[model samples]
Target chain A: GAGVSQTPSNKVTEKGKYVELRCDPISGHTALYWYRQSLGQGPEFLIYFQGTGAADDSGLPNDRFFAVRPEGSVSTLKIQRTERGDSAVYLCASSLNRDTGELFFGEGSRLTVL
Target chain B: AQSVTQLDSQVPVFEEAPVELRCNYSSSVSVYLFWYVQYPNQGLQLLLKYLSGSTLVKGINGFEAEFNKSQTSFHLRKPSVHISDTAEYFCAVSDMSGGGNKLTFGTGTQLKVEL
Candidate 1:
């Protein structure tokens, strides 16, 4: 079975640039989640999608962050005018559903804002 | 809102020695507790969880955690640890409040097993 995967294992960009991160969830999984983890810290929830809609986006730090799950199978997290503070490992996860209680995580996309 | 706290930032133990990574969470309602491990250059992997029914939850790779309601803690413990267990262990709590499946994670405790 294929597990969750994120593209561009690593990304480096300058401040004030726009960036898009992609996530591919497990087969038949209906829920997807995104998180950010800075060095020396645990992952923090950024957003989550249930089916084709975002179930929650409160974890997003500010209006500069937005995410979408158009086909319900894939999700894209977009950041506008990124800053050095946004540099971190962006992680994606999937489960049968949000209530499943177990989450399979992607290897994570390490984003470095130079 | 829910939050988690891990007591130790790093714990170094000898191989075959007992070890415990302490975690405490604060939430207004009942919640689910989980332990995740992150190997170097990798993402977090679920080790164990406690939703209901059992106070002691066993997870993969010979690890377990106990959920304590009165103390507001879900501490991960292993009777004996191996060098292969060296990794960053995170304790998290997820409570679906206001349709938030967001997991509140602790700062993480790095477990180093010395030979």
Candidate 2:
């Protein structure tokens, strides 16, 4: 794709179930990021990956929230034992590198917990 | 840790009127500032950023922002807004350390441009 792409534009899951959202970043982008946006709120950072390594994951809300970017080009955010409060629009973004400061964001995956 | 604050939750303006969205940040270290816009049912798009050099930065769609270090502010402005400019505006900040990768965003300010 010419820009960052996210899969499952909308996801509906039951409480206590698990879900995984995927992100495909722009080609050659070495930095990938994950964020969550609640209704009427701005996106909150969850994690950031530099190549195949997660350079920052401090923003992850809890142990249940995990993300992986094994190939550095594609990433996945996995949530275990999801709660109703965990529902939000999961956003993915990528940049040429952290130094550039401009990030290209995906359309986002809206996760609804029922 | 860096944080951003957007003072106004909503701003209603008539078409062709000027609009300003205020943003403030708190951080001990140097930081980079950015403004992003979100149209209805669309993903966020970068409006402008303040990385270095001149404090006043121009962006797409006739939008601009001024970075003020003393006030720790980056406010977006447009001299004349059109109805099409109605959208949500977000302010973000990132610390200079570690390439300032992670961004802290404000709640957002909704700009309602009416006829």
Candidate 3:
């Protein structure tokens, strides 16, 4: 693909429901990242993947938020028991490699929890 | 820890007027700085970056930023801005020490270029 792609541009779910957001990074890119942005705030880091392994996940606010990249290309961000506070735009980005290269971001999936 | 601070939360200027968005950072290690623009209903796009050399770095869309190591600041400036340039601008940093692409972003500033 020419750019990073995210599934389900918008997702609305009830409290305590589970949701999964998917991301398809640029072809041959070796790094993937996830971020969350709240209203009137900047995007906050969530997780980073170098291939199939998670190189960094320290930025995740809590264990309820989880992400995985099984084959180093497409990734999924899973949230358990969604809360109203969890409502935000979930952003996915990709880079040429883990060490160097600026990020290319997707349109993002807007999650609204009722 | 790396933290970025955008001095102004909102800035309004007349169309074609020069503008400057302030940004400062605190970090113990060397870092790379970037300026990203987010238009309405869109994701972020890199305007410019300061990786190394030349305190001043030029980016797309006629945007340029200067990295000041002593002041720990990277301020973006443009001689003139258009209505299309009216968008949310973010200042971000990534430490090379981290050896990865983990970015710390500022609170963001809304640039409103009025006619």
Candidate 4:
């Protein structure tokens, strides 16, 4: 079975530019989540989606970060104004549902804001 | 809010030697505990979890963790570690208050198994 898949294994962009990272969850998965991992740190939660609606977006760093899962399958994390501080590995994860608690994670999209 | 802390930033052990990675969490309500491992250039993988029942929870790749509610700790331990066990280990906590599935992760402990 296919695990969570993230596009553009690596991306480098200029500061103050806009960027979009995509995630493809496992087939039949109803829950999705986004996280960011900085150097020497663990993955930090960013947002969570249950079906097509976002259940929690409190982890998002600021207003510049937003995510959407309109069809309940694929999700997109958009950064309005990328900053050098935004450089990190963006990770996506999914579960059968929120209750199971076990989340399958994707290889991740490494974003480098220069 | 809940938070996790992995006491050691790195742990180096010889092959076939015992090792333990300490983790502590703070939360006002009931919470679930988990341990995740990440090999170089790979995604995080679940090693074990402690939701309820007994304190000792066994997980993949010959690992186990003891959940001590009183001490607010869930430390991972392995009797004998292999060179393959070299990786970063993260401890996370999720409580009932928040979207039960949202996990708060620790900085991570790098396990370097030396031969």
Candidate 5:
């Protein structure tokens, strides 16, 4: 697809389970970002990757949340021991570079931790 | 750190009526401002942006916004609206401190355009 692609548009998991969300950015885009949107709230930044290196991961809530962009193309977000509070829509976005303020976002993956 | 505020949680207007959505921001350094629209079950799409140049920026779908540096505000406006314009509008900001393009978004305002 020409836009960012996210897998498992909807996922339902029980608390304490592990989950992994994948994001495939547009080809040639060097900057990828991950955000979480909770009910009635705006999307909050999670992590950002620039060319295979995580430029910033400060937005991550805790150690249980981790992301990796091994090849600078596809990235994955991992959640360990998911809790009910983890339920939200995970959004992935990509930009040509880090400097450009514009970001192309995917439809997002809806995660429901019961 | 940067943050955005959208005072109105929702705006209800009739068809063909003018509408305005307010936005405010707080940041230590200069920043870039943007307005994004999100339809049901879809990701956000850029409606307009204020990078540098002009303060009154025009965007797609007949939407426009004015950047007020002194007030730290970027209010979106449209001369008239249609039913299709009903959607969630988000205001975002990204600081220009060379800290990557990480946007801080407001809670979003749902625009309900009625007939």
Candidate 6:
């Protein structure tokens, strides 16, 4: 794709269940980011990956939330023991590099925990 | 550390009227400012950015913003707005100390353009 791509545009699951969201960044982009946006709020940083390694994961809310990019192109966000409060739009973005400061975002995966 | 403040939660404007979305930031070190727009059921799109040199930056869809160092603000403006411009606007800041990668965003401002 010419732009960032995300899977599972909408997901509905019961509380305590697990879920996984996927993101495919633009080709050749070396930096990928994940953010969460709750209702009526702006997107909040979650994690960032530089190539196959996660250079920064401080924005992750808790241990339940984890992300990985094995090949430095495709990334996945895994949530364990999801709660109602975990419902939000998980956004993925990619850039040529962190220094460029210009990120291309995907449509986002809207997760609803019931 | 860096933070952004968008005082107005919502702004209602008539079509063809000028609109201004205010954004302010606080940072201990140098910072990069950005404005992004999110339409219903869509991802955020960059409106403009203030990195260096030019305080006044122009972006797509005839939108522009000015960077005020003293006031620590980057207000988005358009001479005339269209109904299609109605969307949620967000102000974000990134500190230079962090390589300007992670962005801290304000709550947001909903711009409602009516006929």
Per-model TM-score on C-alpha atoms: 0.96, 0.97, 0.97, 0.98, 0.98, 0.97
Report i-RMS for every model: 1.9, 1.0, 1.5, 1.2, 1.3, 1.0
Candidate 4: fnat, from 0 to 1?
Answer: 0.59
Candidate 1 lDDT (Cα, whole model)?
Answer: 0.90
For DockQ, candidate 2 versus 5, the one ahead is 2
Any residue pairs clashing in model 4, and if so which?
A: none
Measured over all alpha carbons after superposition, the RMSD of each candidate to the real structure, in angstroms, is: 1.4, 0.9, 1.1, 1.0, 0.9, 1.0
TM-score (0 to 1) for chain A, all models?
Answer: 0.97, 0.98, 0.97, 0.97, 0.98, 0.98
For candidate 5, list the clashing residue pairs, or say none. Answer: none
- Tens digits of per-residue lDDT for model 6, B38-65: 9988889888888899899999899999
Fraction of reference contacts reproduced per prediction?
A: 0.57, 0.66, 0.62, 0.59, 0.59, 0.57
What is the C-alpha DockQ of each candidate?
Answer: 0.61, 0.76, 0.69, 0.73, 0.71, 0.72
lDDT of each: 0.90, 0.93, 0.92, 0.93, 0.94, 0.93
Docking tier of model 1: it is medium
Docking class of 5: medium
Model 5 bad stretches (over 4 Å): none
Best by lDDT: 5
Query: iRMS value of model 5?
Result: 1.3
Off by over 4 Å in 3: none
lDDT of 3 at B102: 91
Candidate 2 regions exceeding 4 Å error are none
| Model no. 5, DockQ | 0.71
- Residues A20-103, candidate 1, lDDT per residue (tens digit)? 999999999998999999998889998888899988888899999999999999999999999999999999999885774688
Q: How close is chain B to the truth by TM-score, in each candidate?
A: 0.95, 0.98, 0.97, 0.97, 0.97, 0.98
lDDT of 6: 0.93
The C-alpha stretches of model 1 lying farther than 4 A from their native spots are: B96-101
